[model samples]
Target chain A: MWSINYYGNWIMHNIEITDLKRLTQLVKDNHGYDFTNYAMSSFRRRVNRILDLYNFSSVNGLIEKINTRPAFVEEVVNEITVNVTEMFRDPSFWREVRDHIIPNILLNHQSVNVWHAGCSSGEEVFSMAILLREMGIEGKVKLIATDLDNSILDKAKKATIPVKNMELNEKNYIRFQGSETLSKYYKEENGVAVLDPTLIENVSFRKHDLVRGGIFNKFDLVLCRNVMIYFNQNLQNEVLKKLHESLFKYGYLIIGSKESLIWCEIANKFIVVNNEEKIYKKIRD
Target chain B: MKKRSIRRSGIKYCKVVGDLGMSKYKLDNTYRAIVLGGSAGSFQGITKILSSIPDSFELPIIMCLHRLKHVRNGFVEALSIKSTKPVTEPYDKEKLKKGKVYLAPSNYHLCVELGNSFSLSTEEMVNNSRPSIDITLETAAYSYKKRLIGILLSGANKDGALGMKAIKDNGGLTIVQDPNECMIKTMPESALQATTIDHVLKVTEIIEFLIELDKNYK
Candidate 1:
């Protein structure tokens, strides 16, 4: 870990360290967002990128501009927490979920609660909803979409996607062999597809921090995909335990395709389901 | 792309000596192993070729790369999006199992020891990088011997040559990225100089070779 040294008060200017400290402090103070635990190297990269973009010679100059201009702060925060995702990002994984995993859950449980822990911008939540609806268990399902970013969550609540993304997502949906046409799920207005509000009715889009504990009740399936990869192993294990506690006996846990339970202390507890897809079914005595 | 037969280089010692003999029996029947090495500009290409392999591939793969120190982001996650095979950075004392990929962790040199077990060391950086291609290839040469297949991919420095030589010295197969096709040719070029490279192919052709090797042996 590279630690940036701070000289007491004001001695001279080490603009890089100063900018990182100032922005980090600002995030904590303004939004109660603590990015302090994030990997220092990645944090430094984003900090330097923002500093270069604004061409600020000093951290104080950047601070003054951000305090005066809220949009600049928003951009900085947004840059630090970029979430890139797509609908049914891995079609094969989703296929496993839709074909092999969901049927078992339906067979075992009368009702299911699926949690998308880091449900950034809601593409996956909708995808999950579509999966349940296709299985004829839409009404019996409750999907909780959660993210730390309220702004992104607010955008997700609207369920309106860009015209370009909708076209691409339509193609993706078709490739995944979704039973319904993409147009059936949403109405278009001026090239944008406004997703049907009915689809997310049972789905609650809320601001929940994974770092904070014990919000949702026990869930039958938890799809926390591609989110834990950013966390260190300690955090990954911590979150896995929390997710484990949130799962009912014999519940299912699915992770990103690359992520696995092997070597994890929790591996003994879950039976592997399509290890390549990283789908696991919780097995408890 | 040449019809010329590329024969294995050097004097063929008629007698496979000691552990090499044992390893020859173990791997003489096996021709598939996943090999990964990287430097700058490797993200997209690595993922593309890896994902092109089948998810159910039965051979073990070893991957080495230079990672920026102290980044917690999942290099495996980004690559997994492009690969059908499951990817993971190896843990200390993790047994070298088949059908999985083991990546070198950041700031660590990942190597294989005897008995198909992995060893990680934070020893002084080689070639100015902890995940030096030389360290991995050297260790693999000692462990897998002829069972190994080494790949030298995009890199800014000549780090993999000594390691590639180790692989060659142990009678392992070697492949170098075509200098004209590599994103960074230095690493592959160095390996080409250090040993008699068996294949100098594009990324796509390498993928095809791997698939063919996987099918042919397993």
Candidate 2:
């Protein structure tokens, strides 16, 4: 029930932490997906939104669906995942990846292994692919793009973004000072811009939940930009450890320009290679 | 109001029943949060409203003010000066406090998540704005329910319209600054047209109502 304490009257939501745990348990029991480690704040917001969208009477109603209709899990996955991305989002960040990180990666290995974790809708992945092609290393790269949602993975595989978004994407590309226009990598058709299939030939799109997934492979660089902000510190540490273990010695790790590794358990393992670009280098094994 | 064809998804959520005035509105200090949204010409309106709040008032106030996406704005510093209460840009996962004003950080969509804490999203721009009022209000209304007091002030676009609806639908108080008094009237007018507002007051009256409303809990 609602109560007033040091602050004025604080309204306690009918749904409590216990309910969330029960719901997480229910999902894990049924679908084998663990949301227990995911950021609960955003998780609850998404749950309420899904409840509204599906017109479920309560959180209990949503739970009922989880127990019975396994097919509805796809929809739940799509809605819950925050898939915000753009083609060269934060131009300066990409500029650093192109100028410094890529060159650094080349100095260490002939064929670079790049992991784009939480690659929502594949915008960042495709942008990086274009960068690789520009740097003349597209043939030597093994890129894997992964996210928790299968539906978004399908969209990423298609590599088509809205035509209207291309203008902003183009602006970002120019600001990033790409060798050529962003249009060189994609074909525009019917208000949609589709990326060249060849660019994604080396990239594998997979459904991998960072919160629950294990280490899939070692990489020369990992780009988990703009994803962990949805997570809490504990989860960030958990996932950051996974990233740390996945990187080779002196490899690169790039996060969103706004995201940080400060206070994270593995923070000391990484040193900021480029502070403004938010690119870090793994100094130790 | 033209098309009252507003979407109300579930009774589990919120719905604004009717347009209300200051006298018609009832306040018993049950409000845990007061959310205000504004855009163009809002800096002045926000200052006036925050300056009017008394030192003893004790509700956590949140604001989503639209700004240049890339500009490093002194918005928090400026607002902190105008407000009697402590104001700062909340760090990720910072607990929402009483008698404090939290401004949305630049380029981040600020959401009030399930806990009494703020969540930041680098999500796509909504209505061409990063700190979209609709997104913030929807998130806060979902969390706070009827305990929220959402105000849509001066803005250029229709950003806060549906957000005001979200608050009203969940049985929270919804107010819009009178469009006539707004420097840029589209935002408030947009809110008015979409949802029948609860309190259509001038900035001065809004501050007065809020101060008196805070006394309910005191």
Candidate 3:
């Protein structure tokens, strides 16, 4: 291990195989961004990508660079926590959310509290909003859309998407059997699709890290699609535990179509409402 | 060897070119995966290669092939007929194992997810193909690094060239099928031009090389 001076501070610079936990700890300590709970394989892969992208000598050099350049931390956080999602991502999953889960959630409560955790860029949040509006329950919902990456949250908050993305969005809308033409929800001008601002009237966008953020509020429906697959099993279990705690008793949880809760300890705590679409209902106490 | 005996056969084999260097093909201790990619006139070559592998071959072989989007079934089943190792389309989040051949499911780009399992994505097609050869190869290179083996076979497009180069850049072994011996030389020709490939062998030699690699790893 060697030492180096960068930006008038002695940053630890070494060529050894730096411990990933140590790196994340350094980030947590210096930047207050916690990543220790992430799966190491992906954590390591992203670090390696950063090393390649920036031509860092090693993980130490990467950390040293991060220590010196405060602005780079945002880039790192954005890349690491990034989950690319699409509107109506899985057509059938949205169908189930509309037909099966939403009705069940509305059965026990006057309104629905839908939490879109790790809601990258708010695609899923918009999907849920469309469903709620179509179901005539838009006025009776509180939707909290949260992610660790604030830049993405900002984009989601704006709720406007590029016009080109409308092709697949419209395709999915049709596949989902949405009540109205997909164009009725958004106006296109100057090559941009402007969603109705009212779509997000009840939606709140916030920055929240699923890895460390504990339970804060209860939700009748929690849609955390396609995010946990990025996490290792232990972290998945921990986050699922946290999500389980955040749900109202017998509240519905709809995961990504590809994500499975089969091996999670909470698997027994939820009944499989629809396994293919990955919708589960909390077991009543 | 006759190529016409295979299905959709447009395969034509020329002379097996220059000798494969034994030293450079070394399978080191860290090696863990064997990723093979191909398109357009690849079935014959892939079948021949898979059929030639010894029963003792134990690497987790992942294959990405560019077929028409409408190919719903039988691609893996066809390969399993000739593969001594079992071949099956991978389910989402399916765990990896040795001595198995995993096919990238249609309409999805396959990625090596965090848990050493496979994840499928319907993200927009890349290089005009859903099961983009480059996406799978690049992700495998990232996950396995120096422990990866990426082999690009015959095709009509330039999908796997950059990805095979990525494997080489990451210290993983890189192999490309001999362009002169392929039915459609565009893919292999592109890959050969992309990076300093370690091996450029014919279908049979590639198969034997894989068997040898398995032995070396053990």
TM-score of 1: 0.56
Task: Put down candidate 3 lDDT per residue, B109-180, tens digits, no spaces.
Answer: 777764478766554466677688877887787678888989888898888887787788789988888777
Candidate fnat values, all: 0.00, 0.34, 0.08
Q: For residues B1-218, what per-residue lDDT tens digits would candidate 1 score against the true structure? A: 23322311211231234225322112344644556687876666688778888776777888888887434357767777678877888754467777897788765667665556555544335677766677777767766778788887888887778778878877888887777777788888888877888777678767756765665555
- What TM-score applies to chain A of candidate 3? 0.88
True lDDT of residue A52, candidate 2: 59
lDDT of 3 by residue, A134-249 (tens): 99988888999999888888888888898877897888888889999989889988898889989997788888888877788999889887677666667788899989999888
Query: Please, what are the lDDT tens digits per residue for candidate 2 over residues A174-257?
Result: 988999888888898988998899999879999898988999899998999878878877778888999999998888998876
Q: In candidate 1, how many Å is residue B103 off?
A: 7.6
Ordered by lDDT, highest first, the candidates read: 2, 3, 1
* Best by the DockQ measure: 2
Candidate 3, residue A211: Cα displacement in angstroms equals 1.0
Models 1 onward score TM values of 0.56, 0.78, 0.78
Q: Which ten residues in a row have the lowest lDDT in candidate 2 chain A?
A: A1-10
Candidates ranked by DockQ, best first?
A: 2, 3, 1
lDDT of 1 by residue, A1-285 (tens): 011111111112233444566676786787566665543333443454455556666667777887888667666656565455667766767778888877888887787788899888888888887877887889888888888877888878888787767765776687678888878888889877788898888778888778655556888889987666444455667778888888998888988654667757787889987776778888873
